[model samples]
Target: MSRDEQLRRAAYEEMEKHKDVVEKDPYRLHYHLMPTVGLLNDPNGFIQFKGTYHVYYQWMPFKTGHGAKFWGHYSSNDFVNWTHEEIALTPSEWYEKNGCYSGSAIEHDGKIYAYYTGNVKDEEGNRETYQCLAISEESLHFDKRGPVVHLPDGFTAHFRDPKVWEQDGAFFMVVGAQTRELKGAVALFRSDDLENWDYQGVLTGGGEGRLADFGYMFECPDLFPLGERDILIFSPQGIEASGMKYQNVYQAGYVAGQFDSATGTFEHGEFEELDRGFDFYAPQTTLDDKGRRILFAWMSVPDQNEQDHPTIEHKWLHTMTLPRELKLVDGKVRQVPLEEMEDLRVGPAIQVNVELNRETRVLKAVKGKAFEMEITDLSMTEGWFDLTVGDGIRFVYSSGEQTVTLERKSYVNGVVEKRQCSVKQLNSLRVFVDTSSIEVFVNEGEETFTARFYPSPNNDTVRFETSHQAVFTIRKWDLKHVNLK
Candidate 1:
């Protein structure tokens, strides 16, 4: 067999070896996308081509750690039912011998083109980076075209993750980079055709403009226009904790700006974090046929508590968050769960409107391993409100402090950890509870908290408590598992 075929066979064998063990894990997500075996991270090649949605991710099939990644593929016509496609790309060639890192996909002239980073390391441990391309005429089998863009000047080999878009009959690409002086940056490039690319100057970061000396490195840079303003989203490493922001090990945030495509200049605003919870990084967005910007992010952070995840015991790790629709609301990006997600709702919703003052209630019908809960028309007369799901996962909103907090038991040690964000008022909340995860959307997505919790499978109780007189309506529906085959 050829090298590519040999590598593919090895990956298939690895999956077959661990498939039963991974499936038996109680922490496996019921509705989220996870690797069949080994590890999965970074949603790449997310696009809608020929009326079908395709999502490709970074996968390492042989082990539950980062290594030479294969492009795992999945497709859906209605966005609710997903069909696992064949493996899209494998790191068997000379350019991507080490790994095929993250990138994006674009459709041009009836063909789909994917751009990704070719991560290479020599025997001496020196690194070489290349921006590679793979074309798919039918959105299934990909033809690797090798590296189209090499490492540019003044940047280290930490450069990768090319996000490409078409503007005025020309293609523009944004790449995450680190300067030779070790400053995070986003470099721009232009391509007349898909093969040859010309380097433009740095668009932001690297002490070039207002955002000077932000972080040590930037990864998975995505640039797109939402409404009248352009939004640039990237994950930055080496940013220290600042008050309630940058609390995670690495941060994924965005800047609202205007990009002058002719001059390759970006004038932007301050960086704002996309998600306020743990386990959200490497977010990738795609514009569908209906003119909606939908996003899916890796539900686990790098170098945080990866080793402690209970799923690692079952030979698999990490998953993708639920699809979210992005809208520019009031000068900020608001993320709401996709409307198609409602298709997963099974049976009638259990509805309740209650007034509580220094009371706690546990409705028997509002408990499940996987469900969707929405709290609306909330009005509190005084103190705080708390909602505890499963074992130790708690959501609290303090009126006096004007803050929302999510507390969960740490997977590494049993210590309770909390992540908080400031909110002026708590008007509404939409929470999605899966087998091993919780995604909380506060006040119509002004702020979001995405997390993974490993509570006992039998403990599915959801409790509500209030310190003051608070009136709110709660509606919950059990969600059915999406067909993943």
Candidate 2:
């Protein structure tokens, strides 16, 4: 048998061995995508081809930890229902022996062409990187086209994650890279026929004065146009915490700018973080047939409390965040949950209009482990407003300070930790609560906070507390588990 076939068979065997344990975990998300077994990270190869939405993720089927990665595939006709397909790429080829790392997908001439990073390491722990290609005629089976672009000069093997797009009838690719000086950068390249690539200069970073002293390495660089501005989203490592921002171990953010294809220059604005949360990283975006920009991110950060996750005992580790539709509003990116997510609402929504004044109220109907809640038409002429869901997960809005804070018990230690973001007004909040996670969209996606919390399984309580007067209309729906075949 071929080595690829052998590896695929082994992965399937591993899934069979641990499927029961993984399924029994109380924390398994109902409406989110997660590995059947083992570890999953970095949403990859996200695209819509021939009217079908395809999402591939970095998967390691043997254990609930990082290792040689494979591309795990899923497809959906509408964004609501998903079908988990067979593994797309395994780490069986020589160049990608270490792993088939993260990348993006594009549809050209009725075929799906995927570009990814081939990660390889020598015996001495040295690294080698290649920009590889895999083409699918029918979007189900991919045939490897091997490496189309090799490591260029002046870069270390820390380079990977090629995000490709078609601009003006030519294909342009942006790769996350680290210079020999060990500075993070995004290198640009051009290809005429999807194979032969010409190296363009650094589109951003690489110690250029364009950006301040940034991180040491950048990974998963995705560049696309939203509205009239081009958006470049990337994950940068080694950014220290500045106030309430960059508090995560790594940062996933974007800079809105204009890209000059001929000059290979990206005139951009300052970096703005995409999500202000503990467990968001490696985000990838795709433009659908409807011309809407959509994104999916790995809900867990790499090397950030991975071992401490309670789900590790059940042999599965991570999940994908709810797919968000991206919009550029007032010169910044706004992420709103996809309209199709409304299809997950199962029963009649419980609606309430309440006013609070220096008191706490628990709405018995607004409680569930897996549900969606929206508090709209909010008028907070109060000192502070707090919403506590389940056990120790709290969302507090300080109208006096014009800030919103999300507090949850730390997984490593039981102490409650908080992540805060500034807001001008406490207008609206849309919260999605799953078995083990909470995602908050504030003010129509003006800001967002996503984190995983392991509340007591029986603690299905939703409480509202306020220091002074606060009024809002709350509507909630219990979201059903997605149909995954």
lDDT of 2 by residue, 308-341 (tens): 9999999999999999999999899999999998
TM-score of each: 0.99, 0.99
Give Cα-based local distance difference scores for all models.
0.92, 0.92
Tens digits of per-residue lDDT for model 1 on 317-360? Answer: 99999999999997899999999999889988889987788999
Q: Model 1: what TM-score?
A: 0.99
- Alpha-carbon error at 71 in model 2, in Å? 0.2
Off by over 4 Å in 2: none
Q: List the residue pairs that clash in candidate 1.
A: none
The C-alpha stretches of model 1 lying farther than 4 A from their native spots are none
